[model samples]
Target: MTMEANELRVSESVPVDTGQRRGTRPMAPDDVAAVGRLFNRIFRRHDQASDDDLGRYLQTVFFGSPHYSPELGSVVHENGANGIDSAILSVPMAFMVNGRPTMARLLCAFMADGKAGAVGAARLARTMRAARQDMCFSDNASPVSADHWVAGGGIVLPIQSLEWQRSFLPLTAAAILAGRHFPIARSRVLVGVLRPIDRALRRLRPSMRPKTEGECRSEAARVEEFLQCASAMLERFAIRPAWSPAEFDWLVRVASMNRNLGTLQCRKVVLPDGRTIGAFLYFGKQDAAATVLNLVFEEGRERDVAAAMFAQLDAEGYAVAVGMAQPFLMNAISRQRWLSFRHRGYFCMVTRHADLKEAAERNDIYIGGLASETWSRLLTDF
Candidate 1:
């Protein structure tokens, strides 16, 4: 059904002939309910949130983050300040640009797929670019939004969210085959069938899984150790987020916010000589599905890191293994079986600076599903 009226913003007290208005402004404390209603109106999911749940989510997810700022987000009021027409939420973050600490906006959750979609989108792009930030990028834009951003001077990097998985039973063959025929056999159905087989196989042949050869040792990783490993490993990328221990901690906390959800756990890899070669983090646990949040290691230590990860995961009894699809990690583990993958999302950027664009296109910039976007954080549990 066509929308009866487009949410219009006002540029001036008197209306213009073009009908384009400028009712863009930063979200405020009182605008919480309207924003929630708009989100419900745009994406119908999980039964509409109550006013309390919406308020709590706003305060916790949107306002609790270290980068929270009312001014960083833009909302349009088509029916005036009392209601919302459109909005795009972003969180300012620090990234390592050539190993230097730099600021950026991780854009997510937009006013697309709504009644006033076009006007809201254009308004959001304009508002975000005009905001005081070094760069604005997103890892959550769909094809429709991607086209819009491209036409509006945004750059879509050739970054993909590659996926890799291991099957514990013959049922896993369904997932492998499911990719070939889109929406054919259901994945959950396959997994459900394999759950019992996985249990049965573990008792008979514990070594049916691919064996890792090496003296690599993995232990519960300390926060500091993981951060140190990240510092050393990420230097290979010319442009990447300069991670902070606090932010990493905060991301973990956010991941844990959803009750009954899987967790993000860190593991450090060591050699026989007790040298910390690398560290990795993953969500979900053994006999269940899981995904890699990150895998950081030194330049020449890829083998050690990969071996240790495989051994650790195997020992843990994981029914399935998944990767976050970062190019560096996926390329390193290219020899493994990756039956299925998806366009994680488009890493589209809108920047006035040339260096930023160059760095991104050159693959100097390192980004992934977990490192950016709120939906990604929620989806990483998969």
Candidate 2:
């Protein structure tokens, strides 16, 4: 059979003599539309997106990629009627494991219709685990999904699951947080009322004020510069993304497309000697909280780079800054009393390799940012 024919055959439901149909199969390109519809119904109900838009996003993220692998493709659960009821997306990635190239998969957008039940979700999860990959992981699993993952023998990274935030304008940040539930809190009049109080609070607390030390400086960072800094800084870890220049560039471009998070900002921190020590990527708008996508720095210069990044955000008038609690930056983050942390989502992994599991447990692997699915527009855009 031709490759296309064979793929269709595999993705189609198989019937036994008893007339029972198979439950799961490898996801095909044709399944994108149905999967997109299911995703919109489950996760994007508040702001439903068009099937065409979702299909384009899924194609770009899952099918149209330099790292796409047939052997480790995504999986979907099929109902008795041969309709897609659940989907577990797997984005294939290349990684360097102690200097050797290995294949990894980032699981994202695991969605199921109510008809699928827990059994269908579990079946799809099993299909994903059966794929040929060194490791399978996710940092965006919901609480319900996390429970299923742990039940299925996955381990959760506690520290990595927390999100840390530093409020430069505490009252303004509080108002914004409240706005999520009560729209009135987001009114300009209320924000205007809180501005003076936040300013006074910043004056009273030295830690709350943005660091203006001139020891390090930040400038707009290009993808090439970010790749260079990230490659060097991540070498300390035993397992890291082994993206080529082209692949790394593609990843950054895709990440920059998520405008829902806000405008993408890429900056590099340097010293007077023109030496680049760190680079940070985030999305922000004036007078709003910025969501940091990735922050990488030289081994001993975390504090310096972090301070510079915060100062840059303050200058841009962001009310607050937040990001994943990367293990390497915990000390620097703890030193700042103004920063607070809360449980965001579970970071879970399923791997049979002892070394990989050990590295993850020890927090010695690069698991977030480009290594995970947070960059996908599926999570940000409806």
Provide the overall lDDT of each model, using Cα atoms, as 2-decimal numbers.
0.61, 0.76
Which candidate number maximizes TM-score?
2
Error of 2 at 157 (Å): 0.7
TM-scores for every candidate against the unseen true structure: 0.80, 0.88
lDDT of 2 by residue, 1-382 (tens): 0012233234444555656556777788988878887787888764254567778878777775686756566777776665777878777778887777777778877887776545667666665442223677788788887887677666789988988988889889889767756869968899989988888887787678777445899999866777788888989998888888867777777777787667777899999999999999888866877888788889899999988888888888888888889888888777765788988789887765678778878889876777776667776556
lDDT of 1 by residue, 202-276 (tens): 578665455554677899976557778887778878776676777766766776554322566779988889888
Q: Which ten residues in a row have the lowest lDDT in candidate 2?
A: 1-10
Candidate 2 similarity to native, TM-score: 0.88
* Worst ten in a row by lDDT for model 1: 1-10
**What local lDDT does model 1 show for residue 217?**
84
Judged by lDDT, which candidate is best?
2
- Alpha-carbon deviation at 211 in model 1, angstroms: 3.2
Error of 1 at 99 (Å): 4.3
